[model samples]
Target: MADIDFGDAPAWVAVVLAGGAFVISLLARRDSKKSAGAAVEAVTEARRASDAGVRSAVAAEESLALQRQEAAARQATEAEAARPRASLALHWQGGQIFHLVNEGTAPAENLQLLTVSDDAEPLEPFTRLGVGEVAEFLIMTSLASGAPTALEFAWDGQEDPVRLRVPRSG
Candidate 1:
C-alpha cells in the first residue's frame, strides 16, 4: 500500500483510528446479542411459572367439585334412611277371626304378640313382615264370651308397644 500525506498527521494514524472503530462496533454487537439472549431466558421462565400456577388452580377446582359431589351423595343417603314408615292396623274378619295388617312403606322387623285374654296363649313372634301383609290368628274362645279387650305388641323402631282394642262381635 502507498502512504498518503495528511495536512499535519501521518497516514498510519488514520489506519489505526479505523481499526479501533471496527473493534468497538464488534464489541457492541456482542453485548447486544448477550442482552437479547438474557431477555429471552427471562420471558421463558415467567411463562413457565404462569403455566404452573394455572395448573394448580385447575386442580384445586376439581378437588372442590369432587367434595361437593360426595356431600350431595351423603345427604341423599341420609334422606333415604329417614323415609316415613307407618304403624300396623288391626282389622276384624269374623266372630273369632282377627288379622293384623302392616300399612307402612318399609318392612316391620321382630314383631311380638301380647294378648290380654286369659284363655289363649301368646302368638308366636314374627321375624319380618312386609308392607301390606296380613297375619291372621284364630282365637278358640269367641269374642262373645268376653268383654272388649286390648292387645299390646312391640316391633322395630318402636320403643313402646301399641295397644289394639278388640271390638264386640255381633
Candidate 2:
C-alpha cells in the first residue's frame, strides 16, 4: 500500500469542473440552434398548406359557378324548344286583294281576323292555317271611308291578338 498526499487537489478539481461545464454549454447551444431551425421549417410548411387550401377553395367556387351557368343555359334551351312559334303576315297583291299567310313552324288553329271598327264583322277563312299556307281576302277600299292601316288576328291557344301592318298599294 502506498500513501500519497496532494496539496493542490482542490484547484485541479475546480479546473476540471470548469472545462466540463464549458463543453456542456457548447452542446446545449448546438441543440438550441437545431431546435430553432426545426421550428422555422414547421412554420414554412404550415404556410404552404394554408395557401394550397385557399387555392382549392377558389377552384371549387369557380367550378360551382360554371355548373350553375350550364344549368341556366340548359333551362333556356328547354324553354325555347317547348314554346309554340306561330306567326302571321298580311300582304297586298294589287286590286284591293290581300293575302293572309302563316309563316311559322306550328299551325294556327281557329284563325279569325279582327278590325278596329267595333261594328265590323270578324272574317274567318280557315279553321286551321297550316304552316306556309296562304288565304286570300278582298278589301273594298273604295266603299270604306278609311282603309285599314293594320289588321289584328287571333287563334286558339293564343294569349293575345297579333297585329300585322298592311302593305301600302304602290
Candidate 3:
C-alpha cells in the first residue's frame, strides 16, 4: 500500500473563498436589474417620439411640393397632431443660428433640435417651449455629418417631433 498527502492550504480556507464569491454574485445581480430597468425606460421614450414623428410624416404628402396651397393644409394637420398642438416654424438665421417658433394652441414639451442624416445625430441641445413661444438655438456642426440633412424639432420621446428643414449647407 502507498500513501500520498498534499499539504499547504486547508480545505476550509478554499471553502470560505468560494462562499465569498457566491455572495458577491448575488449583490451584483441586483445592480444589473437596475441597469436593465433604465434601458427599458430609454426605449419607451424613443418609441413615443417615433410614433409622433410618423403621424407628422403622413400629414405631409409624398408629392413633395410645399409651394402648393395644399401644403399649408397639410402642415396645419401635422401641427394639430402635436401634443397640445402648436404651430411651429423652422428658419435658418445664418451663422449656425436657427429660429424655432411655437405658435400653436398647445404647449410643446421636450422640444429638442434633431438633425437627420444618413445616420441619426442630435443637433442643438434639447429645448422646451410653450404655446406662442419662440426660441433660438445654435446648431452644432456635429449634426451636419454624413450627408445633406434635415434638422427639426423633437420631444425626446415625450411629445410630437416635427421635421422642419433641409439645410442649404449641403
List model 2 lDDT by residue over 1-170, tens digit each: 03333566777687789999999999999999999999999999999999999999999999999999999999999998887777898889987899989898889999888765786887754699888999888877656466788888999877799989889898
- Each candidate's number of clashing pairs is 0, 0, 3
> Any residue pairs clashing in model 1, and if so which?
none
Name the candidate, 2 or 3, with the larger lDDT value: 2
lDDT of 1: 0.80
Error of 2 at 158 (Å): 5.5
Per-residue lDDT over 50-159 for candidate 3, one digit per residue giving the tens place of the 0 to 100 score: 99888778666644565575879978888757546656777677777777877777767666666465455666554467877778766556553632356556664445
| Per-residue lDDT of model 1, residues 1-170, tens digit only | 44465553656787889999999999999999999999999999999999999999999999999999999999999997788664688777887788888888877788988666676676778987789998887655645775447778788887787898765566
Q: TM-score of each candidate?
A: 0.45, 0.60, 0.37
Which parts of model 1 have CA positions greater than 4 angstroms off? 1-82, 115-121, 142-148
Ten residues in a row with the worst lDDT in model 2? 1-10
TM-score of model number 2: 0.60
